[model samples]
Target: MRMVKVEASVSLRRDLDTGTEMQRDAVDNIITQVIEQGDHALYTLTKTLDGAELDQLRVTEAEMEAAYAQMDEELIGALREAMTNIRDFHQRQLRQSWLTTKEDGTILGQQITALDSVGVYVPGGKAAYPSSIMMNVIPAQVAGVKRIVMVSPPQADGSLPAGVLVTASELGVEEIYKVGGAQAVAALAYGTESITPVDKITGPGNIYVALAKRAVFGKVDIDMIAGPSEIVVLADETGDPGYIAADLLSQAEHDERASAVLVTTSNELAEQVSVEVEKQLALLPRKDIAAASIRDYGVIYVARDIAEAIHVVNELAPEHLELLTKEPMNLVGKIRHAGAIFVGSYSSEPVGDYFAGPNHVLPTNGTARFSSPLNVDDFIKKSSIIAYSKEALEANGSKISALARLEGLEAHARAIDIRLEGNK
Candidate 1:
């Protein structure tokens, strides 16, 4: 890790990968095929890309049973407990349809409605992330979404990993599809014969899937164009070098582009952490990936004080921030930007990623400056409600007409005037 004095500002914002020209063209072609050929395109693409010759597009009851059979009772119990924690956390974020009436009988409020359907794309083929299945699905369920469909690529043997299947089954998500990549995104956006179109799509995938989500955005809502993982540790002299090093590596091993930065006030602590990171990096199975990430994107900034460290952290607006200082809670309100803030030593990043009730699908690559972690709100839409009584309209109608005419909208002005005249 490179150590430097804290500057006026620090940033590690990487431009989101928009894919190459060839990749964009390929994604465009895949979406067109799925739109035109429907299930046939899905079947053909699965065989070509995934090498899985699936007879059908949906997972069967037998497959679900087998997935459960492969899992032991202990793991299943842990998943359930994690699900409860997640549901409880998001349930607090749920909002009810509300209205307020004025003295003149003008009713104004907002109506919150869950999406009719949502499609969660869990990445598969190489690894299975049961935790992702929980994070993405639980929020939508809390928002009262009626239909939730899950899509993932199958293995060469045409079977999803037991973990993926068992997790989705545990969540009561029955509409699982055996598909992945850009084609799966297309099928979710524009329904195939077997799969119904969803109102929104949420999850992370490869570049092709990201490009597909970008293409089908207007047609259906998407969570975000997520980038690689990022972690920023703001620590002081009291911070433990070993804990900080382990936390940094947890995110570094995620991707070669993943960033792990440390902004600290103590030069001694910074030196210790640098050595600790190098020592821990050698022990990781994904040493090559982590080493590359540390080599290219990792850094340690020596700040003048805790205040300077906090300022640099806000400027970075990292995806995952850990305040490993002596007084972590005291600095919570000072942080203005961060997708998720892990306070204190015990509150590590993985705690939030796996079990600690918050959604791990957070904004990355400095998007935390404006965006938020995935939650119930992403699964629902809000509609403004306005009910104007006869008296209320008569009182405000002339002002409304004048404002409309000021914009040179004759039709808008007339609509209000005509209504007022009729009421009179």
Candidate 2:
């Protein structure tokens, strides 16, 4: 890890929001094919890209049963437990439609409506994440969306992973599709003969999937254009070096583009964490990937004090922020930016990733500065409610007409004028 002094001039090496030209071109081609050829394009691309030949786009009932029969009770129980925790957490985020009436009978409020349908894309083949399934699906369910369709890449044998299948089955998500990548995003955006179009799409995928989501965003609502995973450890002298090292590696091992940074006030602790990270990397099976991530994107900043460390944190606006200092909670309110904040050594990043109640699908790179973690809000839409009574309109119609005429919208002014005349 490179050590740098905390300063206002410090900036990250990569600007993840900017898409590469290659990625944009690939996404354009993939989206074009899916829109033109529909399912045929999906099958051909799946064979070439995912190395799988599928007879159909939907997962069979027998496959679901076989997956459940193969998995042991322990993993099933754990999935259920995790599902319960996630459901409970998201249920709190469920909001109801509300209205307010003024003295003049003008009714103003919001109408919160769950989307009619949603599509969730989960990456498959070598990287199967059952926990992510829970995180993405459960919230849409909590929002009471009528239909939730799940799409994932299949193995060479044309089989979805047992754990992924069983987890979805337990969650009562029956509309599972055997597809992945940009094509899957297209199918969700514009319906194929086999699959119905969804109102929104939510989940994390590779660069191609992210690009596809960006391409289809206006046609169908998207959660966010997620970038590579990132984490920042804000610690002081009282923090444990080993814990800090382990937490950093947990995100670094995600992939080469992942970032793991540490902003601390103590120079001694920074050196100790560097040594501990090197020691732990040697023991990891994916040490090469983790090491590359640490080498390229990792940083350990030496701050003058806790205030300077917090300043660095706010400037970075990391996805996962861990306050491993002596007084973690006392520092919580001071943090203005972060997708999710992990307080204390025990509240590690992985807890929020897997078991804890909060959704793990968070804003990546520096998006935490403006965005939020995936939650029930992503699964629903809000429509503004405006109801003006006859008396209220009579009182305000002249002002409304004047403003409309001033804006050079004659039709808008006439609409109000005509309504007022009819009421008279």
Candidate 3:
């Protein structure tokens, strides 16, 4: 990490402009094939990419039970604890159908309903994230999603990761599939012979999986098209370099494309954090990946003041924003963009990613400017409710018809016109 003191305008543009067209095109191609050819295309792609030969894609009950028995008690307990916290948080986000009636006999409100079935795609191969399983499934369960189906690729031994299986079992997810990548996405998007098509799909994977979700968006509802994870640390002279360095590396270790940026007012803190990152990188198991991420996408910008740092963060609209200033709370009102905000030194990004009672599936690559973190709202739909008595319609029908005719929607006008004439 190199430390460079630049004005806020330049730093903002540079950080916000990190977009990749090549990656988008690659993901689009995979989605097109999955939609065009369906299961046959999925099978060929899975074999070519995952290097696994599969006769069946869905994981049997026998496999899930074996996975539960294989795991140690201590790890199982930890997963359960994480699930409890996640469930408790998402439970608060649940919305019930509501209605309101006016004195004139006009009734209006919204009916909130959970999806009948939802699919959660867990990454397979070296990236077996059980944390992701808990994050994706718990919210849907809280929102009363009828059935939750999970999918991940198999290991070389043809078994799913112990943690993945254990988490699924703990969360009451019986529909686990061995399929992965764009093919698994296809199975979830369009019902295959074995796997049942879900009403919606939510989870994270590589570019292929993301593209598949984008392609099948209309066919089945999906969570956001997630890009690489990123973290922006806004610190001052009071911030600890060690803590800042660790938090930045936490996201960088996710992938080579993952970004970690430190924007600070103090030159000394910036330089100290750079050294701390180097020292900490040497101790991490995924040092090569972290190092590559830091070398390519990581940046440390020294601003003239704390206000400048905040300005840069707002423009970038980072997925994760960590405020490590002397008074982190004071800066809360200043933030207008960020999928999730972590205040103070103790509130690190990982806390929310795992144990904290908040959704970790956040918007990435500057999408936070317009998007939000996943929550119960993502798993449910809202329909507006409207009812009007004859008197209420008689009072407002002519205005409605006038507005409709002004827009040249004669049918809409006549619909109201018919109601008014009938009442008269």
Q: All candidates' TM-scores?
A: 0.98, 0.97, 0.92
Question: To one decimal, what is the Cα RMSD in angstroms of model 1 from the true structure?
Answer: 1.0
Q: Which stretches of candidate 2 lie over 4 Å from their true place?
A: 7-9, 17-22
Question: Comparing 1 and 3 by TM-score, which wins?
Answer: 1
Top model number, TM-score: 1
What C-alpha lDDT do the candidate models reach, one value each?
0.95, 0.91, 0.85
Candidate 1, residues 1-424, lDDT tens digits: the string is: 9888865445688888999999999999999999999999999999999999999889999999998889999999998999999999999999899999999999999999999999999999889999999999999999999899999999999999999999998899999999999999999999999999999999999999999999999999999999999999999999999999999999999999999999999999999999999999999999999999999889999999888888899989999999998879999999999999999999999999999899999998888889999999999899999999999889999999999999999999999999988976
Compute the lDDT of residue 153 as modeled in candidate 1: 96
lDDT of 1 at 57: 85
> What ranking emerges by TM-score with the best candidate at the front?
1, 2, 3
In model 3, what is the error at residue 153, expressed in angstroms? 1.2
Candidate 3 has its poorest 10 consecutive residues by lDDT at 10-19
Q: Which pairs clash (backbone N, Cα, C closer than 3 Å) in model 1?
A: none
RMSD of each: 1.0, 1.5, 2.7
Better of 1 and 2 by TM-score: 1
Off by over 4 Å in 1: none
